[model samples]
Target: MRRHKEHSRRLPAGPRQTGPRALSGRLPGAVAVVAAAALALAGCSGSSSSSSSASATGSPQASGSPQVSGSPQASPTPGQQNGGTQLQDAYQTVIANVLPSVVQITTGESLGSGIVYDDKGDIVTNAHVVGTATTFTVTLANSTTALDATLVGSYPDSDLAVIKLSSPPSGLKPASFGDSSKVQLGQITLAMGSPLGLTSSVTQGIVSAVGRTVTEPQGPGSPGATIGNMVQTSAAINPGNSGGALTNLDSQVIGINTLAATEPQTNGAAAPGIGFAIPASTITNIANQLIKQGKVTNSGRAALGVTARTSFNQQFQPAGAVIVSVTPGGAAASAGLQAGDVITKIDDTQVDSLNALTTALASLTPGRNVTVTYTRGGTTKTVDVSLGELGTP
Candidate 1:
């Protein structure tokens, strides 16, 4: 089986994860030709392709910008025309209603996308987009005036953050978030973000799938968040699209665009149409907490409540995870687990390293009881442990 690679969507100076399962960043001036295939909506005939060359601003555009060659010229039936026109009108209406809520976020060191979360000027975006910076420059849609903003809080575990504009301008339209749990397969979704620093760019696609669990590569400027119940889409999520809005035909924000899959065989190039977004439920859950509490007080993620590292056997091979320090009165401590114990498994899953243990825990729910297998003083023992919630450090 081949392991999939994931890359965060911050453009320019973003970190890349390295190793057998590492993800690489798109170079600053990398050109990605987005092929615009002429759609055959409502029985329309003939197909044409337009090549968009990547510009310095990170937007890909055709040479003439608005021109296409070999334009399809097929007459459609009355029924076909009505269906196509209605769909077209829906797309236009949704874009107009939601695009203004999307904005371009610029940290001097990086660039990404954000969504206006409320009328108070709170903006929700990916944590990596802010990336160690407390201040930012935000540019709204259809406007060139740069606004100053400051970080309210960041929850890296969920890869979500909130920033407040120093002085929120009038007529700020907050996006209406939809219930991601109701998102269905094949439902049309539009991704709105600043890809490659191209502000107000939109891409169209369908909800390819839902309930996807993706762990981002951990490194500088990367949170390495193991996000569960993620929404996968066929939308093109290029660099700078992070923290943007993925909306439905009803103009409701369904998810926050986060990262795209990278192919190791292709030298870490982005695999087109395989992007993942943090669902609206997770976004609101985390973003609201950050805005109200200045810190995440209740992270819904599970953890074993112990600090550990990978242990090696006599041959220097990874044998198991050795507990370094047990959190006092925490899950491991309450379960009679002590430091220096080597954990080998959780239930039926083998855990030979810290990362493996983390991945295993990420899949389990907090407060769930599971059998833990570990070795202490050369004696292997099994104990029942109830997992605990993972909180922001």
Candidate 2:
């Protein structure tokens, strides 16, 4: 049972991996714009026949004063002129209202962002941001004071954590979190964080899509959680943006900026205008649990309730996930799946490894009946298994 490594499976047609890079060490500053090397503007030079016709029609008045197609118009109407100004004003107002609720989280070697949860000094952030450090240096937006904070709890499976300030500062503004269920596509969103250590930085974009399942690549300080129902945005999510606030036009935090897709062709460079965020509902659910109990008691994610590892064939090539153990009365056990069973598929998706199994389960909910294909002894078998709710790690 070797550790499950990320096998480079061929992605469909667009962006490949949506892994959130660890912002603790040397991270990419910004999304590099790869401009087209050359613009070949192929023009149809006037043919001899067309030029002869134009010449016969009298060259001076041939085109009837040249028929200016796109002439500049008059000044815009009052409403039209003020439209952009009004939008700019809205942006400024939202920033002024919510920026103070966003804080810069700095550990010994990493930097990230957090949203002030409540006046009790609890702040919600990405678990990857906290990493293994329990203590952190937090700086409020537009404030020079560095405050000491301690970790309350971290739910790495959901990539969320809560921290408490040592000394609760007065005038701590808690951000208003909107209902993620109500977050619609095409809605304007603003991502606020300390990208590249630039504190109080903001990037704007529209909600490109909703209900996306994204998986971060496994790395040191990151569990590579496969997140579901994530809000996809065109916002530029760079390093240090993780765990930051993704807010709507109403000045409400709708999501926590988490993973950004990387261009596989460019050796994992950050793909601009494509990012995923943990919805506000999940943040609140996990944050509340962590703050109250110091750990997540119930994770809504589905699980097969089996301890497994990546299995390989005699040729040493990757095969399927092999069940090493099964929880008593768990989903796998209830379905009569025992140790030595090698899972090859879940429903329709192929399970080539343990990582693939986890990813397959991430998209499903508990209590759903699904077909599981596996190999036991020398025979391949399929069983209907009821998924169980994943427990906290």
Clashing residue pairs in candidate 1 (N, C-alpha, C atoms within 3 angstroms): none
**How does each model score on TM-score?**
0.80, 0.81
Alpha carbon lDDT at 369, candidate 2: 96
lDDT of each structure?
0.84, 0.84
Runs of candidate 2 exceeding 4 Å displacement: 1-74
Tens digit of lDDT per residue, candidate 1, span 231-261? 8899989888988999999999999999788
Off by over 4 Å in 1: 1-74, 314-317
- Residue 227's lDDT within candidate 1 is 81
Model 2 lDDT per residue over 1-393, tens place: 222121111111264544534332344343221111111212324465466656655545553464322234434668887998999999999999899999999887678899999999999998888888899989999798999999999988888899999998899999999998899989999999988788899999999999887777664456777788899999888788888999998999999988887776777776678888999988999999999999997778899999999999899977899999999989999999999999999999999988889889988999999999999887999999999988675
